[model samples]
Target chain A: MPKTKAVDLVVVGAGPAGMAAAVAAAEAGVEKIILLERQAELGGILPQCIHNGFGLRYFKEELTGPEYAHRFVQELKKHPGLKVKTETMVVTITPDRKVVTTSATEGLVCYQAGAVILAMGCRERPRGAINIPGTRPAGIYTAGSLQYLMNIEGFLPGRSAVILGSGDIGLIMARRLTLEGVRVKAVLELMPYSNGLNRNIVQCLEDFQIPLYLSHTVTEIFGEKRVEKVRVAPVDKDFKPIAEKGFDLSCDTLVLSVGLIPENELSLQIGVELDPATGGPVVDSFYQTTVEGIFACGNVALVHDLVDDVSTESALAGRAAAAYLKGEIKTKRWLPVKAGRNIRSIVPQRIVVGQTTPLYIRARYPERNATLHVGDGQTKQQVVSPGETIYYTLKPEDIRTADGWVEVSLEGGRVHD
Target chain B: MTELTCIVCPVGCRLKVEQGKEGLKIIGNGCRRGVAYARDEMTAPKRMLTAVVQVAGSERMLPVKTETAIPKAKIYAAMEEIKAITVSPPVMIGQVIKENLAESGVPLVATGTIAGEGCFKPLEKSLGSE
Candidate 1:
């Protein structure tokens, strides 16, 4: 490490979370802040996502991924207190808010901040992560990586494709490949219903007449140099593959959009306690992690389908960091948050005393006419799906009036409040 | 009564469209957009087509889309035209690449930019072929 740069806050990963956090921290009167991004560009994955349907919540208009990311970058630039370092990968972090980064230009740089925010975001589940018995093939890719190759690098993956997992990314790729004149046979999902938004299911699959095989999983991949075909089998209610119900589909490529895992290597290195359900740090209402002075938000906290939510959550982290620097943040007492009913997980696993916190939640499964009970209040949900993030706000006064902990559960419910 | 889900938003409002004496009555919409979506869906369905077009100078493909929504009936034909067409850079955003696509009278325009010769590998020299 050369010169140790000291700042009020240090944010890792320059995606929506990091960018928004840096901007919020600066705007909240933090004079010095540093945002470190591993990519050569500051916008993160947004550059490669050329499709629309982003920024509906934050910007009030539909914009492409690059356009949505640019909004925060433009906002971050207005703050003179913030410095963005692209292509700088943060290799390690100490429990006491020290970040070590490296880039081609700057051989090794260190940042020692009053508060550190982990906005490392999440990564797509690759082929190796899942068990698909087959010969190693070259045409396999995660749906996100394929989007980058086709959209950013400007090249096609293959001629005909068989995509596994009917997640939003897979559905989007199905439409994208079809638009590029590639043949997509079917999109397979292990669940009964799609793990994507209904709009995506309609526009991406129904629009193109692509079949979606529910309760199905890819059993095997048969290829050597390049993909030739794949075997898909219908799974039971418990997700056990029925070999007798297996069928072979001939295709040249396979794209998997199974799931995402939060990028939390540095968070773990910093010794921040992680929430097993969300695969991210256990945070408080202020986005403060178990290790004081360190915070987390964005997909690093929970996988959000919309980038707009990531921006909103990360901004809270930024403000909290600034408040910590000013000694305005409370750390004496805490209220534990638990998921209840049909809910899967809740971010901000705990709440700081007398603070307003927005709870980001995910459902256990699909349900209609759903109501989320948080504390004493109930939020009526028109519909709920495991694919989307459901949020309920727990006011400070509500927390002050109630027990030491808050509980959030759905109709059939898992509890996190 | 016909049940349909509105694709206007992530909410995916489940709408009940019924034929009454006054024409069509829509229920279960969360917003006014749902009403409009239901109306259009029952009569003339339309969709915005976004796709990538091959570029001559750059190995990068040009992202293009219909300037406005096109009737659903013409989607296949529009796709056929889009598939057959190819253009060279430097293409500017909103520049019309093709006009009156599939008799829909909607222009297919560039949604993204593609830089010209100096930086790109010649189109023929590019790897990954059909």
Candidate 2:
């Protein structure tokens, strides 16, 4: 039988989100907090992301991924009451907040925690998910996987590659490969607009003179032993491939940066309700999910574009968990928040009245001079893109007049050129 | 007139630069930093270089970056210099690796710590490979 111990709080994963949650919980005076990470060391994916342009918001200074994570890691060292467990894989989490973890050092252990915070972050969508018709061959890797191989393991995946999808990682990897003497043939995006930030498009692809083909998709991949060439074609408005306009590009590797899905297997194990739109657990303003004493934040809550927002959101979850342990949180009325016109997704699907609630929203499409209508209050934005997150705080007074529900909509804007 | 996207921050303001009678004129900038970014980008572009260097007697690689942005044209040359050098372990983060990288006048420094052997284990193979 595995040894069982009681703890005040148990944090799963040690990424930016998990690390911030643990640090914030400890700062709230929660003693005997255990942070579990499946990897050998901490910092999660930040260690492998060796690029600049992080920490511009939270720290007010531009930093690399590792540097941004190291700032919080240094804070984790200050709390002696926090127990950080590395290389610990959490196998199951029960509804009653029982956490079961396994590791080589500590074979098997069970922790009955007062509150459990889900911060497992997210995972990359691979080739199988997108159904790119291709010969099952080697030399195909996700953008993130390729990044880990080169930046961490110091191995080039291939000499030349064609990257599909202009997600930030793909764009960044295009430049990284170019700097390392790899020939990046081009970046192809099925959508008319890229899902990555504008800065990434300008610096990573345009800076390196890599051609970006909009409304283009890879129709077929041809290679027996390794990826040798791929057939790409332009897409119509309906996203169907135009076979006549197809062309071939020779490359040794195919890097996919299509999308990222939140890692919520553990969240599902405990039967936490999920939002199909966000593909993550639905939470309230306090970052607490439908299940009592369980909180979700960061990518597990919703895929955020920036790590700065992840740290801020996870810290709220941590403090809320601390409050839950002290019995300060009460179940009151939760107003259903709806996504109206032009809104792709909004976090905090439910919110309690009488508190300043922050809402994170993503537009369905890029628009110019759009006005965001949240309940009775409204704000204007010069430009809003699906690639960027829109942050709005609903004041207590603003929601007081709400008749049991709040709707978020964008109006008075045309599609951006 | 030249058009560019400001990469100074995530806001990513799009700017238009043109040579006016006075000097250079920038428009559509959301902040002051955007103006400076456009001016520098138009005149002499610079970018921060980040790469991994091999650590002697270990399979681990230490991540390093320039203290500041260097001239954009010298990136490949700077990468060559980075590839030619190797450092011993027991190195701390922020330790200077080179005083001036590719004559760009920016110091190259380690961004991660590489402790002695037996204290930290090398990471396992990445799951990206099939």
Candidate 3:
């Protein structure tokens, strides 16, 4: 007996940060809103991400993940106070914002909202979270479930492959399983620089020549039910695995792409406050989240290397959950932000001191001209990377009224010395 | 010298290219499209191809792209002419489907939209934690 209904803004996962936070909370007027989506449609994995470098800065053109989710599902069909559902599924959100969902023509439903915008977008780390030893096979997958079985079920998950983690969806499925004829060969990676995006390692593996290797990995995973081979190796710089400089590599599919995890189990069922270095949800500067009216933006709230910055951070968490459901938000006074020196993560882990926010940041290594700073404001970057994501804004004279914590850092670099 | 990187955007910009003395120079480009992407990576290097086609009766595929960049050595003959054409739906997002494709004159289109055959409902499963 679940039938509830309430609403004023629900938004959970329609992807591309829940259709840009339900079209910016129905263009910030947020009458009823709703938006769920457990995928039956509504561009979540941007329609199985058919690639083409998605929207260059919010549709400044270049689109393709289903034309950047068909321009936000056509502006969420011009909001009639928005109500999209699609295959449904939410399954409990409750911290008093309720939600519940599940569908097959509405089998269970519940809502009671008034704010909640979590946009559950992220997840793809599988292969039992990277333990990868061997045997239990069937040709591994998870370069986003083989890019959703080759771009949304036309199905074709193998025929010579090896890819492991050069990210950017294992370098765009090593050029989409080499333009669908497969035979990809090697992409490996355990870091040595290449958490993807250097123009996806120069257009998806140096434009189809494949073999990226880098610090290499894979160290064992033969066949039995259908994998055939894979031993590869070569890590040592502290990454270890140099077992006789291993090497096996026969193939029949393996994929992986190795990262992204920000689905925050419904933002940990309402306790919220999470940012264990960007596993996401710990917000401020209007993306809200430490659980007030409950808000979160793209990639659950952090893993954004761009989908045009997850449609500009889920359209500012759909206008900050429609200005916190129209109480028109005010509370203020936060300011923590940290992550200094060679920084690794920093998404609004609390901000507000004078307002202007943006922040993001994320460089744990790789620099060029560097110098980011942010507590007293600074900017320089002519190249910086933990695989890109620096963006800064912070002004209000960069925390002048400084209540204390602000950090951010990155500092010096070469610039051709 | 030679280096490269500038995949047009996402601020990749590494560039370097050399031969100076008045000809190709380039060098850590931050813009000018990385000096026309290092003068089209030393001559002729196009890209934008995107794929997925099969959609006649529908095991559904549709996606598509190109209406522009192609010759990165004709992307496997434009994915074997977009894996042997199939489109029969009301399919319209930019429509086209294949005009000069592998000939590299461009035209391939359809960045998604389909509406034919039982309209697809079966393959949804795989939602996270794969």
Q: lDDT scores for all predictions?
A: 0.83, 0.89, 0.81
Residue A71, model 3: lDDT of 78
Q: Name the better of 2 and 3 by DockQ.
A: 2
Going through the candidates in order, the fraction of native interface contacts each one reproduces equals: 0.27, 0.44, 0.62
Tell me which of candidates 2 and 3 scores higher on TM-score. Answer: 2
Residue-wise C-alpha lDDT for candidate 2, range A139-257, written one tens digit per residue: 99999989988887789988889999998898999999998999999999999999899999988998889999999999999999999999999999999999999999999999999
TM-score of 3: 0.39
Decreasing lDDT order of the candidates: 2, 1, 3
Clash pairs (backbone) in predicted model 3: none
Give the clashing pairs for model 2: none
- Interface DockQ of candidate 3: 0.23
What lDDT score is found at residue B49 in candidate 1? Answer: 78
Who wins the TM-score comparison? 2
- How many angstroms is residue A74 displaced in model 3 relative to the true structure, after the best TM-score fit? 26
Compose the digit string of candidate 2's lDDT tens values, residues B22-111. Answer: 999999898898998998998899888899998887666788999998999999899999999898877777899998999998999988
In model 3 chain B, which range of ten residues has the least summed lDDT? B121-130
